[model samples]
Target: MNASVLAHRSMLAKGASGAACLSFQLNEQTPAIFPMRQVQEVIVLPAQQITPIPNMPSCVLGLTTRRSRVMWLVDLAHMLLSQPLPSNIRNYNVVIIRVAQILQQQNMLVATAHKHVLLGLIVPTMKGVVRFSPDLIQTPKGHFAPGLAPCLRGCVLQQDEMLLVLDAEAIARSPILQSI
Candidate 1:
């Protein structure tokens, strides 16, 4: 195996099986991370790829197709902070993630099987994978912004910065996303 891959494996095996996460910027000001295992892939596409859907929540950027499956593209910044991305931005790096089956509600009417539903979260910049020792993850003390609290799994301090670790499953099963 390559040196980088070997290093990643070693990190994953460390500290009671530490969690590996993909760190990204929600906006210029907000930094966050999501479990790497939840992400299927990351794609860079032009703004034109997103077809705007009218009457949808502002957080829902619209729909796009990948590997013949329709995926809902959501604005993570807007969802978390009510701040839409700048209109001048013309491209996005999207993280494609599978919503964990446990997040699906029994009564919800879903067009596709719960396991197949994929969400594309739009992030302006990706900071790469970071591994955190399980011991370093702290249970949130209800100190996060109200909008983001529900979707956050916890927070961890890395290099003096607190990175909110988002719960991808919770985000996928969010009422707002389900209503779409």
Candidate 2:
């Protein structure tokens, strides 16, 4: 769907607590959310649409076109949890995130630059958008799976579900994805 994240963000700013987010699942047991501002779109892509590349990270599921623009698709579970999607799956629930971030780099001197990257994360299940107060987001202690530590922004207990807030910029700038 074509979501206007800026619109959602503004609508959620009733005070200082709420933020609009696009929610999905990494697997059956792990639910997660991405700040709507950083998400570009969500789609269900057929398995035949992706053309797999050779000798890349296992998480890298190769490339596909989104609105005629080519972008890489990754298996979010495999990339973060060391678990791949079931082989029998026919379509992928993909969340496309676009991150525009300032990155610091050093050579003989330190400098900053802006990068815009788009990546499609294929999750096992794609839930609709949700809004929760930012105050409810908790720090990610060592309670989560070890592989999930780096990319986690925090966790939120929404009702009875533990929704993981992920770092979109971190995932966009991942060394694995950057190793092209």
Candidate 1, residues 1-180: lDDT per residue as tens digits?
256644544665463366778889988877889988789998996888888899998899899999898889998888887878887778888999986444435887555445557899998899988887655666765456667888987877666577888888788878888778
- Report how far off residue 23 is in candidate 2 (Å): 1.2
Q: Score candidate 1 by lDDT.
A: 0.80
The CA lDDT of each predicted structure is 0.80, 0.80
| Candidate 2 lDDT, 12-100, residue by residue in tens | 54433577898888889899999898888888999999989999899999998877778899998998898999878889998898866
The pairs that clash in candidate 2 are 17-134
**Cα TM-score per model:** 0.81, 0.81
- Candidate 1 has which clashing residue pairs, if any? none
**How much does candidate 1 score in TM-score?**
0.81
